[model samples]
Target: MEKVHFTEEKATMLATLYGRALDSREADPVLGDHAADEAVRQIDYDFAKLGITRDSAVSVVLRAKPIDEWAADYLRQHPDALVLHLGCGMDTRFQRLAPPETVHWYDVDYPEVVELREKLYAPAPNHTNIGTSVTDFGWLDQVPSDRPALIVAEGLTMYLTPEDGTELIRRLVAKFPSGELICDVFSKLGIKAQKLNTPVRRAKATLRWGIDDPHELERYGLDLMSSLDASHWSTPDVMARLRPFTRFQLRMLKYFPALARMANIVRYRF
Candidate 1:
């Protein structure tokens, strides 16, 4: 028998919300700031039908939190920076970043996800949506080079080989003279284990990346900023409610960066 997991774009959103719901539960005020006022609860309901559990949901939600938190803080450092979200899927990061009218925002992804996003979210004057694969270099020419930029790639990396991931970013950083980029990278272990463990997912889109050291990307042209732990972002109280095994894993991640490498973020300079 095979267990069910979310489809690609849907899984990405579920993952982003999972961390967010946990943050929301922990009373992180920033959590509220990142949520789309017009879309929060409705997005929650849409995910409910997927049958993913609360804990599973929280894990995914945290994916955006670290970077979302970073984006919020990033604004304080550079208010007018442009933000480019790769494989933007259906997630609402522009609303999360709440960029000023002065900030330029771009949401990009496959034509399919962008199509679905249009049904739910319409771009404001400052926000733009482009339907394109990250592998394509066309979108880079569209964003202005005159201002600093921050880029995020959520659940899209796991579908690409490490080589392609590095090249895509190499070009992005090269295309934009100054910018910070953050993304979640899944390892070969997680993909192999998840697919073998859940047969239903293996038949769908594949999980392609599992590189542990996102810093390795420097050779490809991106400057390393930070490596974030997927589990460490959780507060103590949230950790307590997790299953004993999850609690143990959290503890391990806190003390051990290598373990954290299993699921982590690599921030880089352009």
Candidate 2:
């Protein structure tokens, strides 16, 4: 297969997947994503340029674990629900979750990303691939509104402007009668810190939006269920197996509330 050429923002998606794949290769893996590992092997790219290290791999995979858990729970509750994975990238979440056949899965992203995804993934009978930016509300019409929906936006909100991100949430809440949204957001401080984030800087991607308070989503008519500091709540079990110095640094970060607030995993219901 020919190598995929993605833009800066789109390239970051591949970087995260590679990180997860690297983590999965460890003796005791946190997010055991064998599919990601396979994709990394099949795809031709220079991973070293992405600045992904063993330490960063743990952090990236840990961020994705919460979304997987939340989506899995929602699918169990609403077996026949519609799952909309915004900014899906090349993530194999649907494969990992393995929701019931009754669930309809839609992976939405930029055309280039979706095209590459088609090469790497085969959708189930109930699944569809949508090539469009999340900001475009046109694609929403294609999705059925009768069934409850579960929307997941991982590592996506930061790239959008506040206006665009909030509008996307508002549209989703308004479209689905009873549904849940699980997404991660950066704080204002976190947006500033992105400049120093090696992976993000390496990808030449800019972080444009952030939310310091979970209640901020309420402004857009979304019912904020919970917003958790990822550094504290989403630490993967495998983290304990890391070097003592690494574990100590992560533990220290947990005690610093200001620093901890940098990234959060939030859940909202409509």
- Number of the top TM-score candidate: 2
Q: For each candidate, give its TM-score against the true structure.
A: 0.80, 0.96
How high is the lDDT of residue 158 in model 1?
81
Q: On residues 47-120, what C-alpha lDDT tens digit does candidate 1 reach at each position? A: 44444454554565556668787777776787888888887765777876678888878898877657656766
Residue 223 in model 2: lDDT: 86
Worst 10 residues of 2 by lDDT: 230-239
Pick out the ten consecutive residues of candidate 1 with the lowest summed lDDT.
195-204
Clashes of 2: 0
In candidate 2, which residue pairs get closer than 3 Å at backbone N, Cα or C atoms, i.e. clash? Answer: none
Candidate-wise lDDT, in order: 0.67, 0.87
Give the Cα error of residue 141 in candidate 1, in Å: 2.8
Per residue, candidate 2 scores C-alpha lDDT tens digits across 1-270 of: 549777678989978988889988998887899999998888888877898877778888888887888889899999989999999999999999998899999999998888888888876798899999999889999999899999999999999999999889888888888899899998999998998778889889999998999888888777888777856653556667677777777787778987888989999888
